[model samples]
Target: MAKKRKVDNLLALAVLSTIVERPMHRYEIAQTLCERGKDRDMAIKWGSLYTVVQNMAKAGFLEVVGSERDGARPERVIYRITDAGRVEMADWTRELLTTPEPEHHRFVAGLSILAVLPPAEVIELLGARLDALGRILEVARRELGDLTGTLPRLFLVESEFGLAMLEAEAAWTRSLRDELIEGSFDGLAQWRDWHDRGMRPSEVTASIERGVAEN
Candidate 1:
């Protein structure tokens, strides 16, 4: 299998994409990101944007074009994307789209240690998360609806993918909560007892067979 490479930070991708359209100063890159609502999707801090620009320049992904000064304002060095930048951006985008790499999410990590908490407590926490996901789904749906006529589907497809994933997660969470409440999950007793006994030596073999053995 080919190694999967992707952009770990959105600022790099955003800056490269922007400079490809036209050379921009550091401030302008930040401003354009905000204006296009790119910041909402990524953590594009204004303070760090300049540093990123400097680093990209050092890496030869970007080149300083010319400085512009308007009246009392300081001259800002404009930047344009280099051949390297274009290549990296394309590779990053393609990898992101075509490759399905596991991304870190808090809920999954929480689930890994979920047995540490009581089943009821776990259900409550997951319920809260499901409610929040419901609200986010509603907001995404409404926003997508509002944009339907005004913008192209290409612009909102990212949002659509996000919404679909959120919907699936919410549904799965709800089902899990229901199962816990109804004691319908297979091996619920064995699972609970395994955790309660703290994986005793005698029960280790059975627990392992049932797939509840904890490290």
Candidate 2:
């Protein structure tokens, strides 16, 4: 289970990581985060940065040291990470590294209701998805290869991990598609029968439930 924290938004963690170097105003923090590509690494809601920053300050994870103004622009509040913020950041990062949490994927969601689609159509869709994944992997592999010599492995590890995941998905999708095409999948017959008979969705679901109860 994930522990609840004072400021749960990942943007707060990015802010803490950035300002730990030095105090910066909100705009500076956002710019620094963008420059560092934190947005790509995390799910950052740009519009919520200000609210997340304010919430962290209110929770004592960040402290406002002073304010600064540039030209006729409105003053921006400078914020620095507090001791508590450092502790929280370290602990949160450690928790993330040490723990496994369930994450929902759209592909998994589609698979969950997959029986609703005819077996042939499902096979077609899976092939299309695999093709798309192949294209994505091709581009990612080229980019990662280009960056390998330019950047340290430490900096490129995330890209490598992403590529590995794409590869795994592509392999699994290809295997499943092959099973469907070969008529080797265990439930393929029943799946096709349901569609060929034009069984209504509710009737199909009820039949499935009865089968489960019997087993």
**Candidate 2 residue lDDT tens string, 95-203:** 8889898988999999899999998898899989988998899998998898889888987787888899999998999999899999999988999999999999999
Model 1: per-residue Cα lDDT over 136-185, one tens digit each: 98898998798887888887787788778889999999999999989997
- Residue 151 Cα positional deviation in candidate 2, in Å, after optimal superposition: 3.3
Q: Estimate each model's TM-score.
A: 0.83, 0.91
The worst-scoring run of ten residues by lDDT in candidate 2 lies at: 37-46
Which candidate number has the best TM-score? 2
Root-mean-square deviation per candidate: 3.7, 1.8
Q: Which pairs clash in the backbone of model 1?
A: none
Query: Model 1 lDDT vs. the true structure?
Result: 0.81
Model 2 residue pairs with clashes: none
